[model samples]
Every structure is written in structure tokens, then in C-alpha cells.
Target: MGKMLTVTTMFLIQMIITFETSGLYAMAPILSNNFGINHSSIILVNIGFALAGICAPFFGVASEKYGKKKFIIIGVSTFLIGSIITSYANGATLFLVGRSIIGLGYYNLSGLLLAYLGDIVAYSNRGKIYGIIRAASGIGILLSPLTSTYLISNFSLKVYYLIIAFITAIILLLSFFIPKVEKRSSYKISTVDIILIFRNRDGRLFLFLNFSMGTFLVLYFSYIAVHLEAFFNLSALNIGKVLTYSAFGTLSGIFIAGILSDRIGKLKLTKIYYLILIASIFLINIVNIHFIWIITFIMSLSFDGGWTIIQTISSEIIPEERGVFMSLVFFVVSLSLILFYIIGPVVYSYGGFLYTTVLSGFFIIISYILFLKFAKNNTEKFN
Candidate 1:
């Protein structure tokens, strides 16, 4: 019963985050025209939201020193407030403020969710269960863009955010059921520890891979719908449908990767995911409307599959310092946001979506090359 509740709550968190994020992207073109600004202005909102990720390492140490459930409650409470503030936003400044608050709360909840689950589930069964949760997140990927389009076109952004706010309230209630673990005597991310973490080769490899995957997905969410509208003359509804179809690809990957990670071993499965990522970006860019969905699905699959393995690997590394290690790993991933935000718009301005995908493919290729160059069999294993 408890495990079921925990999984259900984690899935809800995935849904709302997807809901807001997909909506922001889908709304970008529409909002740009309404505000008389370019796409950059609307996409810049992600920077405000991503700023909260900067504090993750501190939150990680704090979660260990304090308790996981306590912070989750605070996170949920903060998210609820942010949702209210966002719903009432009439201008970009106000919207940015609301999203910033949402980010603050959101990173807290999202950062801790998997760790909370790890505490309860046995190691042997963990990967499979994690896969199921990730696949469920695909439903959010499937619906949010479509939902955002229909709501914004027929009603208002105000109504849409309010609905998100209501759902957040329920999540706050669900937050209480997350079982608490006993706290350790002391937890600290010391200066030596920080330095050593960066010096660790596998840490660097996975971190680079994580960053590449994260930045690429950010670009996808920020641009794909707009690209369809701009290049293909796709209506909002058709763009949503396209995104929805691509999500099935992600669902297939997450479900398959989860089962395979456990069966084939994470390292073996990871290699396949990397190749798919590099290949998908190139293919996705070259394809026409008729073939875009196939490539997009393949691309989407690699992103989520790679992430699932990354999450599991982080949990396995430094079990005693799992919270700190996981947080630090994600902290590096967060840095990608600032870099991508600045560069994504410039890339799009130069040659449109095609340039963006090509640049992203280069990044993935670089990450893969670095891994092959530096990685050792023992690197991923705790040294």
C-alpha cells in the first residue's frame, strides 16, 4: 500500500512539471506575438525557473542533515503558492517571478523524489519499478502540449495555471504519505569532497552526458512546437498532436530501458542509449514532416532511457553519500541550463531548428568520445 502511494505521488510530480514545461514551450510563439517580443523573451522564462537548481547541493546536504519528507512538504507548499502567483500573472515580469518561485519549490521536490523511493524499494527490483514510473511520465509528455494549446486557445493562461494550482494542492496532501527515513549524525559536502568529485573520471563522464541530454531536451521543449508552426505551417493542434506522437517513443524507451538495465546490466544498456542519441539528433533534423515523428520518437526514447540509467548509477555510487552525490550530479546538469539558454536562441536565429539539432548532435558526440577516451571498467564502479 505504501509503495503504491509513493509511486502514484512521484508520477504526479512528473505530470505537473511536464504540464507546466510543455505549456511554456507551446505558448512561446503565441506569447511572443502577444507581447510583441521575439521567441527569446518567452524562452528566457526557463532561466528564472532553472535558477533554483543552483541551490541543489545545499538542499542535498540539508536533506541529509534535516530530513527528506520535511523538505518535500516545504517544496509542495512553495509550488502551490507559485502556481497561484503564476495564474494571476498578466505580464512577463510577473510570470517570471511566479516561475522562479515554482523552480525553487520544484527542484526541492524533484531532487528528493527518487531518493525517497530508493529508501523503500529493494535494489534488485528498483530498476523495473523506476522504469514504470518513468514510462508513466510519458503520459504527461503526451498530453501537456495538447492541453496547453486547447486551453490557451479557447480560454486563457489564467485558467490553465489555476488548474495546475489545484492539482498542486492535492500533491501537497500526498506529500505527507512519503515515509521518512532516520537522519544520520552529520552530513556535509566538504571542500575536499567537492574537488574529488570533479576529479573522478566516471563522474565527469556521466555528468557530461547528463548535461548534453538535458540541454538537448530543453531545446526540444523550447523549440519543436514553434519549429512546426514556423517551418511546416502546423496549427497549434497539429503541433500538439506531433509532440504527443513523439512521446510514445519516449514511453517505449523508458519501459524497455528499465527492464533492460536490470537484465543486460546498466553499463551495457548505456552504450546502446548513447549511440541512439547521437544517431537520432542527426536523423531528426534531416527528416521531413512525413518522417519526423519516427526520428523524434527514437530521439525521445534515448533521452529518457539514458536518464533512467544515470539516475540508477547515481544512486549506486557512494551509497553512504547518495544524497550528496546525487545532488552534485544534478548540480552539474543544472549548469547546462544557463549555457543552453544563452546559446539556443542564437543558434535558432542563425539557421532555424536545423542548426540547433546539428549543434546538439555535436555535443552528444563529444560526450560519447570523452567517455570512450577516459572511461575505465572500474570508473562507474565505486572506487
Candidate 2:
């Protein structure tokens, strides 16, 4: 009975994260146009979210000391408030602040959702369960673009954000329904422990892979809409269609990678995921054919699918430190994402579309080689 309730709560939390992120992404281009800004500035929507993720370690420690249930409820409520503020934002600064607050809420969801899963499930079945939770996230990704695009076309951005705010409110309400979860163990969070986490060879390797893959995802997602607008001369409505298709591809990858990881082992599957992702980015750069959405969908499948695998693998790297390690995983990923925000637009400015895309691919190749070299032989330590 206890286990069943835990699974249900985790699944609901996954849904909340998925819906919030999808709505934000769907609103990205609209926010850009309304604010009179470049795509780079628009990319900061994600940056805000990533920045929130950067703070996950601090929050994780707080969760341990204060209580996971308390932090989660507070995070969800705060997110709802931020969503309301974002709906009314008039300038970039106001919009960004609001978005950053939303990011804080999302970090709680995204950073802790899987760790929570890890806490409740057995190690042998962890990969498959993680995959299921992430795949569930794709449901939000699938719907948000479609819904946001429709709202923007017919109603107003204010209305769209209002709906999101309401959804966030619902999430907070649902959070209350979660039975109190007692901490099984605790740790004193200190500066030195934080340093040890980063300096350890195994820990550093996991952090690097987490951040690098995160950067790669942000670069493509942040730019793809703008790329379509500039290159294909597509409207926001049309671009949403392409994004929706891409979301479907991501779903396919999420489920397949999750199943594969259960059978083949994360270490072995990771190499394949890395290579395929590198190739996919190159494919995005070189492909010039007119079937716009097709190419976009394929790229989404490859990149997001690959990302799902990396995420699952990283979760298993330091199981004893699930809260701390997950926090670091999210934090480093968020930091790299901020770097990508700057890197993507600056590189796109000089190199244009194709060159910028190819550059991101090169980064993946470098990181892939490094992870392969540093990864341990057995999963015993992680367990």
C-alpha cells in the first residue's frame, strides 16, 4: 500500500514538471516577439529554468534538514506565484525574474522527481522506473506546444500564462495529498562535502557528462524555432507543428532508451547514445532538404532520446548520495545551460545556422570520449 502511494505521487509530480516545462517552451517565441527581443534573449526562458536547477543542491540539503514534503509544497506554491507574475511581465527584467522563480519551482520538480523515484525503488529496477517517469514527462511536452500555440493564436499570452498558473496551483494542491515521507538518513551539508563531491574522480565524471549533455539539449531546443523562422520563413503557428512532431520523436526515444537500459546496462548503451546524438546534430546542420518538420522530428528523437539515457545513467552513479548527487547533476547541467545560452547566439551570429549546429556536435564528441574514459567498470559503488 505504501509503495503504491509513492509511485502515484511520483507520477503526478512528473506530470507537473512536464506540463510546466512544455508550456514555458511553447511560450518562448511568443514571449520574444512581445518583448521586442532577439532569440538569444528569448533563450533566457530556459536559462531561468536552468539557473533554478543550479540551486538544486542547496535546496536538496534543505529538503533533507527541513523535510522533502515541506520543500516540495513550498516550491510548487512559489511556482504558481511566479507564473502569475510572468503573465503580467512588461519588460525583459520583470519577465526574467518571474521566469527565474518558475525555474526554482521546476528545479524542485525536475531535480528531485527522479531522486524521489530512486529513493523508493530497488536499484535493480531503478533504470526502468526512471525511464517511465521521464517518458511520462513527454506527455506534457506533447501537449503544451499544441495548446500554447492555439491560445496565442486565438486569445492572449496573458491568458495562456493564466492557464499555466492554474495548473501550477493544482500541482500544489495535489502535493498536499502526498502522505508525509520520513527521511531514512541525513547529512550535514557543508562547503567541504560539496568540494569533495566535485573533486572526486567519479563524481566529477558524472557531473561533466550531465552538464555537457544538458548544454547540448539547450542549444538545439533554444534555437530550433528561431532557425525555422529564419531559414524556412515559417510563422510561429507553423513552427509549433514542427515542435509537436519533435516532441513525438522524443517520446519514442524516452520509452525505447528506458527499456534498453534495463536490459543492456547504462554504460554500454550510453556510448551508443553519445555517438547517435553527435551524428544527429551534424545531420541537423547539413540537411538542407525542404521537408522541414521531418528533419526537425528526427533531430528531436535522436537528441532528446539520447538525453533520456544520459539522465538515467547519471542517476545511478552515486546512489548513496541520491539527494546530493542529483542536486549536483541538476546544478552542473543548469550552469552549462547558461553557458550555452551565451554560446549559441554568439556563435550563431558569426557562423550562421549550419556552422553553429556543427560546433555543438563537436562539443558532444569531446564530452563523449571523456566520459567513456572515466566511467568505472562496475556499478557496485553506485548501488
Each candidate structure's TM-score, on Cα atoms with residue i matched to residue i, is: 0.93, 0.91
The TM-score, computed over Cα atoms with residue i paired to residue i, of candidate 1 is 0.93
C-alpha root-mean-square deviation, each candidate: 2.2, 2.4
* Tens digits of per-residue lDDT for model 2, 232-330: 777778777778987887787777777876676666676776777776777776566366666677676666666776777677766666777888888
lDDT of 1 by residue, 37-94 (tens): 6865457766888777787778777888899788778878888898899888887888
- CA lDDT, candidate 2, residue 209: 73
- Which residue pairs does candidate 2 place in steric collision? none
Counted clashes in each candidate structure: 0, 0
Worst 10 residues of 1 by lDDT: 374-383
Off by over 4 Å in 2: 1-5, 24-26, 45-47, 184-186, 374-376, 379-383
